[model samples]
Target: MHPAGPAAKVIATLWWVLLGGATAIFLFVAGLIAWAWYGPSGERDEWGYVIGLGLVFPLIVLAALLAYGLVVGERLLPRPGPDVVRVQAEARQWAWRFGYDDAPDRETENVLHIPAGRPVDVAITTADVIHAFWVPRLAGKLDAVPGRVNVLRIEADRPGRYEGLGSEFNGPGYRDHRFSVIAHDAASWDRFLQGDAP
Candidate 1:
């Protein structure tokens, strides 16, 4: 049988690999921020914004998550279950067709509809050359190979429209291979499933 959970190991591995570098950069900037602001009290005024974020926002979030991870341990991982929305994204010559279980009649072309705050599981495979599905605001993109299906777990906390781009340069018009993601509230999601425009 497959792993019992949402393959948290894979997600965590990917997260650290991608964010580790960014975290280092953030820490370096944060240190500069502190030195500029509080090191002298005769602080570097130009770093005012960075210092503020270092003290309160970025570090705070990192701490909170660290604490949670330490406390909850394995429970912090996402579990595989029915509630996880599964999306099958198929890429053709130049467009994306997103198929969701709730929308069986017709695939949403060029638009991905997801319910905000819920876990979205995507099993992506390309019909042709390699392609990558990337939505920076929500989650990192994974490669979609012709014969292999890659699974991605994504969660969008806010309800809004976000942009997704195809990172792999398959051929011509690669730049134009982009789509939009629409995150909706529960009620709006229901309406959308019922064929209502959201």
Candidate 2:
């Protein structure tokens, strides 16, 4: 078999990177579309469109690098570690409760603590009428209904404070069915787990 020439090798590399990058970009775009159209109010914004545009050029550069790695040489894509967290939530007549596996006994009212840069799975269920759980900054939303559990995944890329509002109208307090999501590092997470906050 003949060895690939320099130009051929480069072209192949570019193609491979392009494919990977395109895949990533496609997923990102899909998320954006879901967010803008189907996601909650906070997700729909003109700034998101602008931000999407800004990412195009950089995405192209990464795609090129990925292509080069695949065609010209073998490169291992760095997989982010398994840093996913799960927070189970239950909906009752007039409130929401959050619990972590390690600390299931502790319940927080309308406040959820999650680790940043990690995938979070929220299993939601309702004790009564249907309720929706939503957090715009992290990801999309899902419904919480009686006798059923809904799974929602969120990945907060950055650490900060975000808001979550129930998209469903249940009762008079439906408007008050809002909460705050606090994304923190490992240290803060530990503290929260220890019940050190108000």
Candidate 3:
């Protein structure tokens, strides 16, 4: 239900699947324990249970989950694409400075603009202490450390305004550190890039 973009959809699906898998494993183990304790005690295959159920089951389940999670994570990475938009997000003090690749001189404070229905790669960095860039409705969170740039891929399915924030506790003013992302239509985005729209 929180799926606003492709990456967000993938992440939400992974979360649900992981929760389902965890619930299934819990119930299975609980039922098995109940059966073993309440049922009639006979000659049990100690080695078989130990090897097959304990070791093999956990290994197989963990391996499958790991593989699935890695695949999902790889899919969410910022891949090279022709239509991908690039922007710079620099965190300092309690504000976000956004610079568009299309416009070198143009800069916005605490507000980011992008074209809707297109992949946007945000190169995040910090000028001062460590902070985090998080836009829950668009994509996942990534830390912004000094001297390091971490790129995050985000997209919006439609034209709207999405809220973003600095998730790390860099200082006392971090509580009010917030931003907004304005996803514009194709024409509006073009106008905005040409210094027509704000």
Candidate 4:
């Protein structure tokens, strides 16, 4: 529930909504069980309970969840923006390489630097087997497939450091395939772009 960016916020909200839907379903089933065992004897609307409560309600809830996911997924895409920072990410067996669009020759390994409060579009690919790019507090995961690039949108609301990792089980060294994200302020970002340590 500790979300540091917009995408993470949406995902956290989705989790809460899923929990609520599950709770509602559980309560409904429990109510049905109680009614079946302890309620006063009467001719219940069997069709109504079976069709309306059992099928229709669940379908409606599922449809709503799907709609919400679609909308949220669209919003999280790496859309073009004036302030968007583009970065290239290449995943290997147990390492990550991050290169900036502004500084093409400069690349960082296992340490990604992004400006705070701005959307970043990371173009991800893999050198070998498929891997997953994930920064849990910032956004969802995207596969880094060989010979194909996948763009994942991520951002930080403020200047801070966050943890990132490759989530796929590519090899025995996968457990150490971790990284860090340093979200810098405007000045810090500029300095880092100009050859200063972040």
Candidate 5:
């Protein structure tokens, strides 16, 4: 799947980095095991190699990964901007409701409309049980807890439709708790804002 925006792109990058690192370590360990089991037992001092690779390497990699994750997470936080679009996302039972701050009375269920190439901040909360709003191609999952608002920033690189869902199971209808994000171009997005589209 294509990553629709910067946050997803960063997450995708980190995923690949983690995967590659883990694969490399696995292969190295496997090779060491094979050598120890099959090769001739010689008086070789390889304790340093084992300790360095098994302990020091993982420690360094984990620290670097943590730092990178924090940096990316900070970038994903919602920032006040003149051009930023704000929307309210409410979860209850097994449905999602989206409301635009610009048009208080206008609301959409299970479908969110946003402008492409612009930052959109979604203030997420739950009316009942806890849930998680997740759009893999757009951004990471953010928990929606009762009495708490969690804001997440999402953007589309281009005009398209992306899939979203309630990642946390709350009730029997949780399996159907899916949503779609429709990203429109500047002109079409303006028309949507003008209440010209349903």
Candidate 6:
């Protein structure tokens, strides 16, 4: 499936760019090898072409990619916004607990509910060993460490469900450490906050 929001979209774009660049590099090197084996012997030792393609081109491409990556990463960071919602994610041995900042008493296990078409800042930490919160369709993964709190911002383009899990290997129950993200429309999200739904 395609990415649902801006952050995931940026990541997807970066992935495609990397794949294309790698493929191009591979083809160029392969072509050079073929030419060396089968083309005119006198022209096979072209220093200028070898140096330019093997050194200069890669350096330029790598520098450009590094700059592009930094720009995309900066865009994905959590920023203060008027309608931003905050949630806290706590990780244990093999389970996840989500607490809403707006409704302190309301907590849910293994299911995160948020409003669609808006940004959500998820504060993540671990009660036990380290874990990683990863929801592929929405945003990138963030580490959940015992004594550290990391915030990851995510958004859903529409009302739907997305899967998430602890990406890092912890212990015996690591494989079962899974969760779901449920995105609701504005009214449904309000009702959820007001405790009208379980």
RMSD of 2: 17.9
User: For model 2, which pairs clash?
Assistant: 13-67, 13-68, 13-71, 17-66, 17-67
Per-candidate clashes, comma-separated: 1, 5, 0, 0, 0, 0
- After superposition, which runs of candidate 2 have C-alpha atoms over 4 Å from their true positions? 1-81
Model 4 scores what on Cα lDDT?
0.91
Native-to-model Cα distance after best TM-score fit, residue 22 in candidate 6, in Å: 1.2
Candidate 5, lDDT over the whole model: 0.89
Give Cα-based local distance difference scores for all models.
0.74, 0.70, 0.90, 0.91, 0.89, 0.91
TM-score of 6: 0.95
Model 6: per-residue Cα lDDT over 1-198, one tens digit each: 489987899899998987887787777788877876788867444787789777777777778888888998999999999999999999998889999998999999999999999999999999999999999999999999999999999999999999999999999889999999999999999899999976
Give the root-mean-square deviation of each candidate in angstroms. 10.8, 17.9, 1.5, 1.3, 1.6, 1.3
lDDT of 5 by residue, 33-58 (tens): 78878878878667975787666777
Give me the displacement of residue 155 in model 3, in angstroms.
0.8
After superposing candidate 3, which stretches have Cα over 4 Å from the reference? none
Where does candidate 1 stray beyond 4 Å? 1-78
Name the runs in model 6 displaced over 4 angstroms: 43-46
The regions of model 5 sitting more than 4 angstroms off are none
- Candidate 1 residues 84-109, lDDT tens each? 88888987668888988768874788
The true-versus-predicted C-alpha distance at residue 39 of model 5, in Å, is 3.2
Residue 68 lDDT in candidate 2: 62
Output the worst ten-in-a-row residue range by lDDT, candidate 4: 53-62
lDDT by residue (tens digit), candidate 4, 77-172: 778889999999999988999999988878999999999999999999999999999999999999999899999999999999999999999989
- For model 3, state the Cα shift of residue 22 in Å: 1.3
Instruction: State candidate 3's TM-score.
Output: 0.93
Estimated TM-score for each candidate: 0.62, 0.57, 0.93, 0.95, 0.92, 0.95
- lDDT of prediction 1: 0.74
